[model samples]
Target: MPGAREELIAHITEKAVFHGDFILTSGKQASFYVDLRRVSLDHRVAPLIGQVMLDLIAGVPGVSAVGGLTMGADPIAAAILHQGAARGVPLDAFVVRKEPKDHGRGRQVEGPDVAGRRVIVVEDTSTTGGSPLKAIAALEKVGAEIAAVAVVVDRATGAREVIEAAGYPYLAALDLADLGLEA
Candidate 1:
């Protein structure tokens, strides 16, 4: 969480990026947007974002892996894998597809098999908590012993309760206030 959190947030803010004012995937409205893929694709920002997340979950016990829905969670998985491997934590990763890939493999979850694995679902943002919940369902279906759900930003929504009600812990590296960007 060291350099990555500060530097990555700075990059996102300085970009002054816009993705159009439209309904969010969670049906929420906002004056701004986070083009996560754009930021995640940044050669520098992506790895740091992943490292921040790894540090966010480092204290959590029984966490055998890190992962979540694709697109939002893709770079996160890769970053965690790289950091974990480097640190000898053996943190595996899995992807919970938006829908099962209908093509070859016919797979929904990708990466280390989650069956009975202690895992953590990661997300870049949380508005209504829908995305993380969907990933949770996918992991549960595969017998994944999910330890928790973590996000880089919480957006001050009720995502924490939603995840807690499902009997999994929730963590956020920063809330809207932390970056002085909250409405």
Candidate 2:
């Protein structure tokens, strides 16, 4: 049997990868798209994603929480939180809204107080690195020290360069080759 990471890759390749023309969040055109939600939200695949991602971010030290821009990052953070607990890692998860809520506390970063804590921004997949960058900005406003940016699948389309150029270490669990795709 394949290990957690390999199994997760298989799941993603089989269920998440879609071919043909597609427009990515980065406003770039692509021949293929990796819709991780197709498997990230699945019960069987979620745990696999959590395990694989945990291993991917193990090198980064002092990560108290994990999260990123809403929608894409939501499930990935939840998976890490649950799986980390199972492994006794004790990781908290947060959500970064595109914009601050107008009501209640009018907050943007939701969940535990990440203020002054180290966090790893996560996403299901990365294209141009815009989403994680946006999340990093919100996290900075709340005083969260970003340890790194982690993604499940990297399209190999300059996201790594964009993120590293912005001064954050970028980590990816899988890439286009791992999914039998190309940039």
Candidate 3:
């Protein structure tokens, strides 16, 4: 049987990896993109993503929740919470909007109470780490202690440096190298 990492990678490789000239969220031009939303939203791969992400944070201490910027982080956070529940971990999940809502509460971070809890921020694919960093800032504003930044794929450009420079550990399940793409 394939290991969890292998299985997740296989699924991502098969379904999510894309090759094309595209402009990324960062406004940088890239020859390829790893669009994980396709796999993350799939019933088959979502649980696997959760399991793998759960494993990524299992050894870390005091992680009461998982969350990140909306869209990229949504499915991953939900999957982690679901898997955590099944395993008796009971983690809460949340989303950080790109901007605080203009209406009721005007909240940027939404979900269960996260104040005073350690959090793991999830991202689907990271290039410069802006999405996770935005999530981190929003979470921190509400007093959420960031434990780590976890991503499904790292483009291996400047994301690691940006994330680490901000004082949090970073982890990626896969990267451009894994998909045989140039950084």
Find the candidate with the highest lDDT and give its number.
2
Q: What TM-score would you give candidate 3 relative to the actual structure?
A: 0.94
lDDT string, candidate 3, 4-50, tens digits:
78888888888887888988767889887788888999999999999
TM-score of each: 0.87, 0.98, 0.94
User: Every model's Cα RMSD, please?
Assistant: 2.4, 0.8, 1.3
Model 2, 1-183: lDDT tens digits are 789988998899899989999987778899988899999899999999999999999889988899999999999999999999999998999999999999999999999999999999999988889999999999999999999999999899889999999999999999899989878
Candidate 1: worst-modelled 10 consecutive residues by lDDT: 13-22
Model 2 residue 8 CA deviation (Å) reads 0.7
Candidate 1 at residue 161, lDDT?
84
Q: Model 2, residue 163: what's the lDDT?
A: 98
Clash number for every model?
A: 0, 0, 0
Model 2: residue 40 alpha-carbon error in angstroms: 0.8
Any runs in candidate 3 off by more than 4 Å, and if so which? Answer: none
**Best candidate (score: TM-score):** 2
Please identify model 1 stretches exceeding 4 Å from their true place: 16-22, 103-105
Rank candidates by lDDT, best first: 2, 3, 1
After superposition, the stretches of candidate 2 with alpha carbons farther than 4 Å from their true spots are none
Residue 134 shift from truth in candidate 3, angstroms? 1.0
